[model samples]
Target: MLEAVVGLLLMLLGVSHGVETYCDGRQDGAQCYGALGGTVVLQLMDNTSGISRYQWSIKTTTTTTTIIRWTNNMIVINAIANRSSFTPSDGTFRINNLIWTDGGEYELEIFDSDGNISEKRTLQLTIQAAGYLPIMAGVLSALVILLVFGVAVVCAQKKKQNNKPKEKEDHELTYADVRTVQQPVRQMQKKAETEVEVEYGQVKFPERPQQTVEPA
Candidate 1:
């Protein structure tokens, strides 16, 4: 049971992390461009438990539908770091300034502490055509705006839901002013009773003593 509970908690935490990362578009693919011969930084994630090592390489396909390792073209930009790894810890890798020949597919391989290897993740890097960056930027900006707007709407709905009962309570209290109106009616009734009592006391019983003597 305890193991199950721990597993459940881990799953929940993982899901929450994924949601936060993806909602902000942070978990998406790493971006690199080969325009004008600039270096592109690529990031790698373990996406699993345990310490891992990372390797990066590039390859090409032959016309006969076979992949050939390009030993001469392979570049080791970084060595295997300890445990978890992310690329270009400080910043992006810059290619040779203004070179167009650097465009290719970059591959990242991960190995677990137990020596279990993962399939390589590859990113296609291409030199951008003129005006391509602007279009990509606009699309990314629009997606961000839409996500922010959706979150705002959800928050507003929650706030309105929380305030609904309070508004209803205020309306109910306003309508219950009947108690205040009845207070004056009670006071007026008491005042009328006092006036009647005063009038009765003012009327004296006359000749009560003479009537008593005649009876005697």
Candidate 2:
């Protein structure tokens, strides 16, 4: 479809037009956005020939700090703005290593040739901490993958244990087996010895003894 092709082309090409700047101070009261821990470039003015001195300050809710102050002859960048650079010819200010505390209103005081205030412009700058989400997501994904791999390894070990062959049991002898191994009596005695003799007899009685007893 046409939409898909357009989307692919947009991805292949970049989002930049001729120049990229956090804020443009061509007019007064401009607003700018910068990413946290990133860099921001500002176009302060079209030309810096008429300006004698340029003083830039950032104002927060509680305090205000001078970031950079420069003149046509000498340029002095503050310690807090150590990573910042400015071009006097084109009035472009580039700041690096942005933080959350850097979000506030910035005031640029421009002085004329006679040391008179020519223009005092204030621009609102907001810093977004949007660069860390992708990092956090990637770490979470890696941890999830490691956990899944560990679980799979443990499951594989258990399956290997289940599929392994069992060992054979030892064969021990029982009481019945011991009895069968002993020798049994092959034959009994044919006759037993007699300790005493047994006897059988027959007796006859006289008849005369009965007649003598009748006379008496």
Candidate 3:
């Protein structure tokens, strides 16, 4: 677990140890490393007080870019060298957000106030996709282990849920709807208060005479 964590941090942080590169210019000083999208700090000189002017440039196969230069006590950072900073006090040049193209040999030229040549030094920098691969085998192993552990946890949870028996469905109840309709009641309307009930008698007329027509 610790190894996995360390590997992950290395891959993410791009953390690497920097060797103290002096202004010897004799030894091709040990190489420094910068991680992609990371930062790198290079020590150019011990003291800036002795140096009246200095220039730093990185030489790559395709092109050479001036990272920073100081002259007449004025510091001028190259327009192309973005995210690069230099401190006159410590003579340290820091570059952030490194890219693959930044890998190259860096050279420093120091001059005195009298325009006299001083000492020169050079250092190499390597750009890696990750912080340290040989140390941790990159981030692949850690990611794989994490992925496997996550999948196992998911499978275990699914198995637990499947093992739990579903409760039997409750019996469905049948229902019959009953409805009653009421007959309408007739309402009598009131007329005049003195209106009496009138009754009509049946009139019957007796047969006047059974008149037979005499045969004349």
What residue pairs clash in candidate 3, if any at all? none
Going through the candidates in the order shown, the clash numbers are: 6, 0, 0
Alpha-carbon runs more than 4 Å astray in model 1 = 1-131, 175-177, 204-212
Task: Name the top lDDT candidate.
Answer: 2
Residue pairs in clash, model 2: none
What are the lDDT scores of the predictions, listed in order? 0.46, 0.67, 0.64
TM-score, every prediction: 0.35, 0.51, 0.52
lDDT, candidate 3, residue 9?
60
55: Cα error in model 1, Å:
45
lDDT of 3: 0.64
Candidate that beats the other on TM-score, 1 or 2, i.e. the better one? 2
Cα lDDT, model 1, residue 193: 100
| lDDT value for model 2 | 0.67
TM-score of 2: 0.51
lDDT of 3 by residue, 84-203 (tens): 776667766777777787787987778777887677778888887655454355456666777787788899999888766432222211111111111121112223222323211212
Rank by lDDT (best first)? 2, 3, 1
